[model samples]
Target: MTPSIMSLFMNSAFLAMEAQQVVWLRMMRVAAGGASADRELSRMATEKMQAAIQLGTAATLAAVGGNSSERIAANAIRGYRSRVRANRRRLTK
Candidate 1:
């Protein structure tokens, strides 16, 4: 990949982490008498869960495939999933 693309991917990964943090914070707010946050948190969590399932499935397909389409789709999903794996590697300051 080009350096520019790599940098963009890095930025996107950080953005995704921020989005996840926001979702968690919203959940906390909902717990602390912020009922309005519930709908948003629920929506965000549902979307994230669906995405995670798709990524996990694609990763699994990449792990075990007999034909070509599965492998191709897996590779494409893996590219997207790399950002997710990056988000998991949080830094402590």
Candidate 2:
């Protein structure tokens, strides 16, 4: 594989790990009774909606611009990565 592809794969792998960490952190918080069921469900729903919007927008732009599939995937991944990073920071504190 090319260096760029390798880099993308590596970054994606790291992102996946971060995403898992965020999930585990949230689970821990809930298990510890730190968050109410209603609030947690609402927050999760809102986050999923935002992610869907972002992915849709990215895909639309890529299609209109005749960009490659990899670019679309990269853009989608970027949106998730940012959300995951923010969640990690918030959960840690």
> If scored against the real structure, what TM-score would every candidate get?
0.38, 0.83
Lowest summed-lDDT stretch of 10 residues in model 1? 84-93
Model 1's TM-score against the true structure: 0.38
Q: Kindly list the per-residue Cα lDDT of model 2 for residues 31-85, writing each as its tens digit.
A: 7774464576678789989889878987998779997777776777778899889
Question: Which lDDT value does model 1 have at 50?
Answer: 76
User: What would the per-residue lDDT of candidate 1 be over residues 1-93, giving only the tens digit for each residue?
Assistant: 223455556665666676576546655666766655666567657757877787777767755765354444435445555644543343111
Candidate 2 ranges with C-alpha deviation above 4 Å: 1-3, 34-37
CA lDDT, every model vs. true structure? 0.56, 0.80
Q: What would you estimate as the lDDT of candidate 1?
A: 0.56
